[model samples]
Target: MYDHASRPGKPSSKEEDAPSPDKPPEPPITRIPSVLPDAETSPAATSANNTTPASGYAVGGGEDGGDNGGANLRRASTVPSPHFALPLWRKSVIIMITSFTALSVAFASTSLFPLTSEIAGDLGTTPVVVQVTNALVLFTMGCSGFVWAPVGRLAGRKQAWIGASVVFLLCTAGTALAPRAAEEKTRLKIFVAMRILSGFEGTFFHVTGQTWLADIFEPTQRGTATGFFLLGTVFGPAFGPCISGIMVTYAAWTSILWLQCAMIGVGLVSSIFFLPEIRRPGDTERRKAATSSVLGILKEFNPSPVFKVMLLPNVILTDLTCGLLSWSQYTLLAAPRHLLNPRFHLTTPLVSGLFYIAPGIGFLLGTVVGGKFSDMTVIKWIRIRGFRLPQDRLNSGMVSFFFVIPASCLIYGWGLQYEVGGLALPIVTAFFYAGGLLMAFASVNTYCAEVLPKSRTEVIASKYFWQYTFSTAGSGTIVPMIDAIGIGPASTIGVAFVLLGGVLTFITAKFGLQMQHWAQRKGVGSP
Candidate 1:
């Protein structure tokens, strides 16, 4: 019999193997007790009272020991909770407006594809030059978030969002006028410059919107809020081409940019008044202190939550899986024209652009369903285990990873490749594929947000920054990959990635608690 090395006292019973108390608890939401019971302050709260100066928090006058006063402190720590309920009618109106703004910018980002040929012809440039502008814009958008995330951390969310919209509006107007402003050589330069500027400005809708929702909503309500946010993101890309296709057919290429510019103006005005500033008093102080060189200050601010997450092998592996899944998403968006035009022989922009609806519909439904089911499942899991863990949400992605991604890629790829089915078949497959993508995204993104509730804005922003960077790479390489490998092989590779993502997600679900313990043992962030 083989013997293994062990400590003098027969290795402790496996039953005693629970994570140490010093490690931060799993499911960051549950870890933070409901601001502690008002009347009976815990030791943690008492310690905080001694350590935090009077200036550190906003105070409302109350009976010295009143429980209600504690609630006020909690409120001041984040967005000051609205004392009077917002009228449902007004709330709905703002949500719609914000959603439309996000969709319009998103659509502009991708829709210009269908008009590339028409735009190039009018501007007297090769189509390649016209399309290069798209790539440059997207690449710029990916990096812009890194710069904006820190700024949003410093300035309030509403102000940051408005600033981004202002930039976008100016860039859009510039692009609309660029064709007539210069010679063909200079035309490309102007176009590229405008697109890059627009891309940079586009970062606001993603980072600001996400952080804002975190500020306003409680943990339980977050899934629904995230679902709505996903709708804006999903619909923007899905409908961008469809709208652009119609505009280019009926009007000039300049109309697309002009329309976007006008919409930005409207959104900017509405957001300024409607989107409340959600900066906490504590965050305000931190931002002021951080004014001494942004880079140095951001470095000083702890990234322990993010770094500790990486220390868990499963999280790293799972992030890669998410990256690979995103590769197919950007590739599909980038190369659709190639497949639609040649195989279906769809010549008109309207016919080619209509193809987007199949997937867009799927994405919308997936987000709603995924968000609800993930929340329900998380609640059920907590009951059964008699304990809650943040990794529970990671399990929600398993269904999407194992079934939706691979099946959708294979069917969508093969359907277009052989032209073996009716238009409806491809459309249905596209919808399912999109649904899976959004469902997976809902889980993956929420996991990031929930795992670091205290540093919610930076954590959420960091995730998007990295995710969009993957999107940039996928968008850039899609044409080449499709050209070299052809659709069938390219999709097969995507399917393999989906499988890998599933395996890693399972690891996160099962061993995440243990990993949290290991991080603490290795001296990670405070509990």
Candidate 2:
């Protein structure tokens, strides 16, 4: 619920937002609350709320510290201070632990990729059957966030994580211990069901973790903090198959599940003992007071709100940006084995595992460097304009979107197509392509949270929804497409999508304010 000239996060009186020669102008980044309001904020009512402060404090927080605006961000929270009070160290620890959940879930999703033969043999099925189940796990992991993120939004974030953890642990064990003696059909059904359910439990880590982290972090801190948070998601894919290969060599295929279970066990223990509730104090009592029946509580899980968020012009456009980027992302992740194996005659598991190091290192470098750059970009814009729009962060990713990815992907594709530079060329391109992919992804992920400050949960859910949809499509089709068309041509098609994503980012960055105005006038964002 941002006023056109107002700072982001907290809404305020129009008088406060207006610039004067006497007072300091609005800072580019406004402070967000230490705890987000658990319910949706009515942005359409911004007109009247403009006459009043959002809470007791001035909505414009002190840009330098607790000095300039005389506003404390925590004053925006409705709950008593103690419940939402998290020390700095606690916040870091929580984020660090939450990173592992994303890593572990992503780890479990692909750990079976290298052990398809072992899994199929145990179930008395073909490797193809095992592969299909794994693909579904990845797909379900993305789709499930639409369901679980809303639950975290309406219930407590801590509660949702705890429930998911326990369920995920149980489901992983079910997959691990699926009896070999059973009929193949029964065993496969159990295997698929448990794996899919575990995936469902896993996807919420991104949505819920980001939301909780957002609640505590200020606007300026979000980009770098998010980089840390997303570290797991970007690296997990490359690392998973590497570890999976190692596990199946020395231990049974079930060792992957056991490892996943161990990670879940740590997460469960940490959630109970270490993770503090991010909800407002007495939030439970308030929910009870507000809702009369079990049906009322269950209604929050309905996904229409998520789709409604999808209707916002800027939001939908941003989601499309992510969806298109995913085509390139999964293409990069999926293409190496198919493109490199025959081209370079590299077939060893170690060779395959080692190849990931290039992209993994690139992803690692991008997240940290790109995240810091995003924040710097936002500040640069704010200093120039005397204010910041959420979309200002998009400028930082332009390098990757326009130049790094398209250029690198094309070279990688055609280099393979012509066998021009030998194996080294493809590996080099993978690093740059992967680096560019995550560089573009980092700012976009944070923008999803920023674009709808009040509806961060739904907006982010929408992000993962579209991200995974395209990811699943690309993963399923890339190898076949490469076989049909040369890698260069297929990659060109992917680059076309990446170029479209850049155009979308350009539009959002340029016209985001107007688009938000249009969404409000059309009442698309209204409850």
Candidate 3:
């Protein structure tokens, strides 16, 4: 009774004969459906592609375009689907390995702090010169993101991770074997150069590692994943000084660098075998094109995008907030050695270094708890509003900003100022302070990764650009500021900046969507 091919949309015999021979045939209609059908057609998907799934989520570009605007719009469509879906256990393993890799890099960066005097004496230099090496490493670490972000873009994240680890391992060995020169200046120069090379390895772990995690996890699960990843980052600085204090107490200062070399070697080998290439489907072609020639590679190295991300109001606010937090973070790392050594009249590096454990534990707990809490907050807000926005996660940071950080910083500072509770008070306060910092950090870090998914690596690089610029300033000047104004006032300055950052964060959370629309309209971060 019915013909199979004669559907309502198709023309029957009479209609089919109406067209002239010169008329061109219409192209076949193609529907490239999403993995999750509901996601592709949902109301929220039509707006901005922000939605949570019941079990797993779908991946696709925003309706308007990829976050990099028109220039990357075509690339967004070409982005390959993930090669394979990894099991949860396998995904966890990858995250853990990358986190440890990050930890090793961070540990090497700050290990010299507790051993500054020992390193200076051995090389016939002053503590000032040794301290300059610390600032140089931090500065280099921040700037290295520019170079490595492009490498990740063109060469593949897997290669970037392995390459950085190998280079770090070699550089750590070089630092350990640095020859002592007759002149202090010459020896210092060698150490500075080696430290810079080592610092270059850090950006891969921080930037590319985060980028990799974002690639694997869904929005619902990303907060938890990012939190765990940050544990390695936050704990490394605290643990670095703790370990270095013990090492310098018994072993030669060079032994610390040797230990870093060994640890990094393990990470390099593990990453080579375990880390999979999670490139998009068409990314292989993109990678080949990007690497076709010297000019292609250089074209991929454009740092303009990193600066352009800063043009967005939300991004600049987040960057400034992170910069403010770095002031306190570095102050915490640098001050302990200076203040504890003198205040307690301690002789051994081990005793002074033991003090770092309190904050280290705090940093560990905060990242884990804060990360889980952020996810919960997102879920709760989704139920209330029936949709999710990236800024919703920022509400979790408010507690850390208003209460935990300010109170603990005051107790740590003024407690030392008036000598109220001795070393115990400041140590306990340091624990809470570090905890608060990480809690706030977890929300912001996750937000950055989600803000511009199309150009996530570049956006993240921009974050670190401002974040570490302030960190370099803090690391270089915190001790001097303590000397000039007393610990209480210096710490109060950090608290003021924290409050300002908190206010900005609140404003961004409330108006972030509007700001994003403005950014999109103005083409602020267009490639």
Candidate 4:
């Protein structure tokens, strides 16, 4: 489980290949055929640059020191390369800033939940009407990836990110200043429109962030980086209601939107200053080859594989597992206030929001820990088998699929039904539920990205496209389903989904390699 390498537990080489101390390395070859040359290359030669051999993969370069030679030798021996040198702290900061921005948008998207009652009252509408806004936002955010991904590919990561942030900021500000429903007769419409617009902007951040992280982090350290990113996304929805709950009570519901607007502002500023470009080595050549018209960039970025993956039996089945498992996930956040607020007579938004902490903590810890464990276990599996496959991560997720989601759903639902709605019941159940989700998600996500490394922009765009689409549908339908069926039956339904999801996950883990073969056979992600 451990190694003495400079990076971390993972070894730099599969086998020990020590460099000879006496060798003076060949002069660094700028013309080597690898990915693209560094940006420092003059623009005059940019057009003539051909596809180079893979050179960017080196984790670090050796150092050169004067005089003593031993210190330089040691530094050169230990340090991989300095060509792409970035301190871990800098990488982590970028991850935090980008991830937090993405997550804060996610929170703002759902932050209206704690204020649903107040919003409905002020707007002269029922809770159902307010709830519909939440549903549409999820749907829009999911589908919006198609639009954003192509733009990111064309304009570059930084430009596209700032573009999305600008839209998010504008829409959020509008939502805050929207007129009352009675006075404007169009206030609800305006609010809903703004939320949907924000959702579209929000999806860009997730897609961009996913690809950007993949570009920056090496395979071994990806888990911790991804874990931090997941923390932002997973914790946001859970944390949204709690913070907004306080804001709604102390200030107007508008204050939550205003706060969101400010957050978007921060994200926009960070993106302009800190976000770096992450095009592939030969991406410029590929893009130029693909199209000459500026508008053609959008046209060339097709969604066929994305749709094909969606239609795959295993992929579709995996999505079902994700969707069903998420039933409890979304429902817990959406409908809990109705139960607690009425039964316990807890009317204050802040008090109602306090209920989210149980699931929120569960989600954060589950994702962070699960991601770390996945990284660790994959190494173990590689050691045992004497080879490593990308799908190995999928195998690790099978353990969580069997134990976590179903158990948590049962405990949560039955605990509520038996009139055991104490704090401990939901808290314990939530930990398991959240754990299962992260475990499953980490695997599927890593597998898809790895399998389609060349087509990552499109692949990830497709992944989020479906994931959030399912989330939208779940958020839209969960409350109504709960209303129709009692908590006992509602949870039973969730358990049934979890069971199916578990079975599908098991099948994918077992057959994921074959699926990859199939994808390759079909030329799904060929470079």
Better of 2 and 4 by lDDT: 2
Worst 10 residues of 4 by lDDT: 39-48
Per-residue C-alpha lDDT of model 3 across residues 388-420, encoded as one tens digit per residue: 567778899999999999999988998887878
Query: In candidate 1, where is summed lDDT lowest over 10 consecutive residues?
Result: 36-45
Q: What is the lDDT of residue 513 in candidate 2?
A: 61
Q: lDDT by residue for model 1 over 208-249, one digit each (tens)?
A: 666556555545555666777768777888878877778777
Model with the higher lDDT, candidate 3 or 4: 3
Number of backbone collisions per candidate, in order?
1, 0, 2, 10
The reply for model 4, stretches above 4 Å from the true place, is 1-85, 180-182, 286-291, 294-298, 311-317, 524-527
Task: List runs of model 2 lying over 4 Å from the truth.
Answer: 1-85, 153-155, 289-291
Q: Candidate 1 clashing pairs?
A: 27-390
TM-score of decoy 1: 0.78
Give the range where candidate 2 is weakest over 10 consecutive residues by summed lDDT.
65-74
lDDT of 2: 0.74
Write model 4 residue lDDT over 460-487, tens digit each, in one string. 6666666676677777777677678777
lDDT for position 205 in model 3? 83
Question: What lDDT does each candidate get?
Answer: 0.65, 0.74, 0.77, 0.66
Best by TM-score: 3
